[model samples]
Target chain A: MKEKEINFEEAMKQLENIANELEKGDLSLDESVNKFEEGMKLSKKCNDFLEKAEKKITMLINSDGEIKEEEFKIEEN
Target chain B: MEYNPITVTDLNKYIKEKFDGDEMLANVLVKGEISNFKRHYTGHLYFTLKDENSLIKCVMFKSYTTYLNFIPKDGMKVIILGSVNVFERDGVYQIYAKAMKQDGLGSLYEAYEKLKSKLSQEGLFDVSHKKKIPFMPKTIGVLTSNTGAVIRDIINVSTRRNPNVHIRLYPVPVQGSGAAEKIAKGIEFMNENKFADVLIIGRGGGSLEDLWPFNEEIVARAIYNSEIPIISAVGHETDFTIADFVADLRAPTPSAAAELAVANIDDVKETLRLYNNRYKIALKKRLELMRLSYEKQIARPAFKNPTQKINEQYMLIDMKVKAIQSSIQSKISEEKAKFIKQIARLDTLSPLKTLTRGYSIVTNESGKTIRKVSEIKTGENINLRLVDGEKKAKVL
Candidate 1:
């Protein structure tokens, strides 16, 4: 199966669809197995995305129509 | 240095003239606490303004009193702008107030209200125009003073909730002089640059006068026109500014704004975990059902004992073979009986059998049986067939 470049939200949505399809229990065993595998793969991907997300704070500077990013730090109160 | 003695009315008039002639008395600005304040039937305000040691009668006539932002009341500290002149009838000096204001934040409050209502009428504060804040904002912009706890509190709260969230601070003057313009500029700048998903425009708690910049029209418009969703947290929970009304969302404080900007990643992770658990359970159940159905199919007769079905077919074939064999045997027996009957009849009609019953048959030399001889023209050889013997003779 060609897994396209899917975002977190899309992945979650597809996972939900797969879950629903499986839950309905109207599919053949082969089809249900395929859906379960696909859904599990998506769930793993979503979890990975959440875990690997790192906080990045950057200040945007527009100089002469050019936008640049600089590291932003919170000043100690 | 008057030589002529003047009457009491003349003396009082002269004193009033002297008081009016003084420039300081003509336009006096006095700060005192009000006592015995009264609103006359004609909409005039009569009050006594006094300090610890000095007391002066003050009167703001209906003409100027109508312009006053607040009604004067006893014990309220106020500043009166009017001329001090002697009242010839009372023969005492009093302040004829042209205008009056509370000692602190009096005029500023009026200005704030004026701008608030003006902006409100223009639909800037309408809920329909307010944008919804993103459920999960990646970047949070801060438009507040750089040298204060506002930014720090926001950062602390945001980072504590979701360490992955980004904070972009556009340090602006939160108060004093041109702070309103700078704050507005900060909002626009963030919007133009697409700096952040949401913005927090505010400062920590302060007096109404100190927080006046947030009430400025420019700041309110900035918040209203902001393409980026803004959370106005200008002061404490009790403090409501124009920015609060125009903002897409209002947080009670800067810290609260940060809390609204980003959701906890742990909660999101927990949600994912929940989904995962649900899918797993559903899949398991599906597999279990399928397995049970498969078990039922496997338990079926054809699947359980495949040869038993073949055995059933064999039994049917055996019965058919026996039926065919019985019909063939019966047909053979019937044909044998018919042949016996035919042979018996043929025996009765046979000449040999007739000979056995004392009947004989004769044939010529040509071996042709002669049924009856009308005349024998010449003697011919003949043969006779009897039951047990045959003889040759001449026909006579």
Candidate 2:
């Protein structure tokens, strides 16, 4: 069975490696086909991971263990 | 000693006239080492011009001070252009300086320019030689005083931006004797040991004398030669130094340098999210293209009725088989008709047919239907065999 999931970093690294190998043009037809298939899977996985990510906000406190949770606003340029 | 009631301005004017008329006091060019210099907030410079034996106070307004390219420091020899004057209120004689120039190229500026030009010639300030600061540095090496607001500011800004960045402080004096050497050594050590991805060398804002170590040739050379990219953040924004020129990057303040070194974790996460979104969008587009192509292929006649293709080949074979069968049948029939004709032609010449037409097939009792007379003897019994029946007899 093909792997249905991969993290963003792993997928990106794999994609980069595949791209490099393809650029080198050393792979046989069968190997190239296999790599292309794997790259497609990884690309899909990365896209899926990115689509699901949401921005999370948290507050910072001093070493005294004080709780300070405030609404963090994203600054706009 | 006339007891005349006069205003302060009158007394000041009377004393100014007396000093202005004196030939020796007017337009005196004084040569002395400067001391206790203060640039007034109103843009006037006040300092004491002192010789080994005597000292006099002098003032140069903003109009004159702006013309000076180099900052005049304490103990620097300068030729002052001013006239002698006495204030009646304090009875103090002073040289109100109009202009001043350096007595000589002092030890500090000379060393500064010498090292700057040398390193610049060696391509230290070249853009190609400067290493780019990593977008997200994992660790930052700080070379500064152990206890100072500089470290605090750096920590505050960095942690605020990215909480996870590791900071290692290589404590060294930021000024005074041996300070430049220590700072240089710290930079070298951080680079040699690969302690951090980037280094922040800085101190808080201070007077030029306080920030002298950063201007030292040693510190500048160290920054120029550093393998790890260095961000020089010594003093305020207006302050420029040799270290600033040699460093891979220059930041106005320590906090700014820290900000440059690390990426905000939140911002990076957001960026990553955006990238992921873009990847997803691109993937979706590609898949749509693939799907469209697939649909087009499926809509093709070959895909719609695969059996039509098979039937076309099947019909070709069927036609060929029918052609072969028909040809074989016709060939067999034609040959059969030829054979029958041949048989009919043979029957006409056959002796059996002649026998039926009243010609006798002579034979002996031996039942040998003889083609020659030698096959039968005088008393031998023979039987004649025709195409319809056969009669047999024993040979005598």
Candidate 3:
């Protein structure tokens, strides 16, 4: 969801779907391999995405219908 | 000197002007029980305020009734601040109330109830209209005052839940006049830009009046109409705002809203790992099962020694061919014997047999067998055949 290109939820759901398909044990060995590879790739992508990203915060301002965003930093209390 | 008498209206006007001139009457604060309560269709409240011994007429005009937060009813004790004056037309003295409060409670609670019921009846709080909050919101648009514990709490909570989650604070007034409008506008702005998948709108705890903007109709309507799912966290727990009812989800506090809005990245990562592990285990199991079945098939004798199996089939074919050839040979032999037997029977009836029995078959020169002596020439050469040899003999 953060990247929009990679919807984390969708990727997770698809990975789960692949897991289920593999667990059903009806697919040919070749098909199972393909699904396993796909699932592994998705898992890696999600892991990297979560691990590499840092928290971002921005203060928003609207002036005359124009919205501007500025980096926000928490000040010491 | 005072012989002339004026009209009742003129006398009443004089008394009213005198009462208006008195500063004490102009600004009076009274606490009494309400009786003979009636509301005019013109939105004026008329009631009699009385102690045990005496009573005074009070009228809160529609203009001043705007300040009333509760519906005044009979027998309800109240403190009213207004001016006492004479009504010139009716020749009656009444208090013009500017504001009224319930004896022990502020009227804000009643107003809150009133609006809550009104909006509830309108189905603004219908569950079916609520949008589902996202499981993982990339950005959480927080609508609250920027410089407060509310914002700080939300940031702390959200970042703790998922450090990757971006927070966009659309700072808005949590209370005071026109605060509702500002909040509503913030919601609109967020929605317009598709700023966040979920919005957390709220403030820190405050008094009922301080949290009034959240209970406002405009803010409620804004929450209702927002395309993005909203989590309302107005004031502390136990404080209910109309925004809470209309929002997709309600958190008791700003921190709770943050918790509600963000998905824990670690948990999600763990889930993904589980899925990966499941895929690994399942696929490995599947491969192992296939390999075992394949190995079992391969372990069969036919598969183990393919050449021997083929040689065995060849040997079977050779045996079958040999058996067929032998059967044919015996059949030929049997037929040959039958033919020999038939030949022997025929041979016994043959003239050659008589030859073999020491008789001869004689024929003339023309190779015709002579059956009687009359046809034979005396000196004609003839051939005679015995069984084994031929003799030239004259027939006598």
Least accurate stretch of 10 residues (summed lDDT) in model 3 chain B? B102-111
Better of 1 and 2 by lDDT: 1
Give me the TM-scores for chain A across all models, comma-separated: 0.79, 0.60, 0.77
Give the lDDT of residue B27 in candidate 2: 85
Q: Residue by residue across B1-396, what tens digits does model 2's lDDT show?
A: 889798877878888889989988878887999999998999999899999898889988888887886688898789988888887677677887888877754666777778778878987778887888876555688888767688778877887887655677767889888998888887887777787778999999875667889988778778877889899999988888888888889999999999999677677566545544544444455556667879999999998998998899999999999999999999999999999999999999898897776556656654445778776666666775655665655565
| Per-residue lDDT of candidate 1, residues B106-199 (tens digit) | 6777898898889989999999998988766657888887667888888788888888777887777788999999888888889887888889
Could you tell me how far off, in angstroms, the CA of residue A41 lies in candidate 1 after the best superposition?
Answer: 5.4
The sequence of per-residue lDDT tens digits that candidate 1 reaches over residues A1-77 is: 33333454566677778878878888887887788787777777766665665677666565675767788776653
Tens-digit per-residue lDDT, A1-77, candidate 2:
33333434455566667766654555655565566666666666554444443333222222343434343332333
Q: Give interface RMSD, every candidate, in order.
A: 2.4, 9.5, 1.4
Model 1 residue B39 CA deviation in Å? 25
DockQ result, candidate 2: 0.05
Kindly indicate the candidate among 2 and 3 with the higher DockQ.
Answer: 3
What does chain B score (TM) in every candidate? 0.63, 0.64, 0.62
> TM-score: which candidate is best?
3
Docking class of 2: incorrect
Off by over 4 Å in 1: A1-18, A25-77, B1-132, B147-153, B163-165, B192-194, B204-211, B236-240, B362-383, B392-396
What's each prediction's TM-score?
A: 0.64, 0.58, 0.66
Candidate 3 ranges with C-alpha deviation above 4 Å: A1-4, A61-77, B1-107, B300-303, B339-396
Which tens-of-lDDT digit does each residue in B1-396 have in candidate 3? 669988888888889889989999999999999999999999999999999999999999999888776567887889999999898878899999999988855566777889899999999999999998888777889999989798899889888889888999999988899999999999998999999889999988765678899988989888999999999999878888899999999999888898888888778877987887898899889989999999999999878987997899999999999999999999999999999999999988888778777898788788898888887777788998788988787644
At residue B373, candidate 1 shows an lDDT of 73
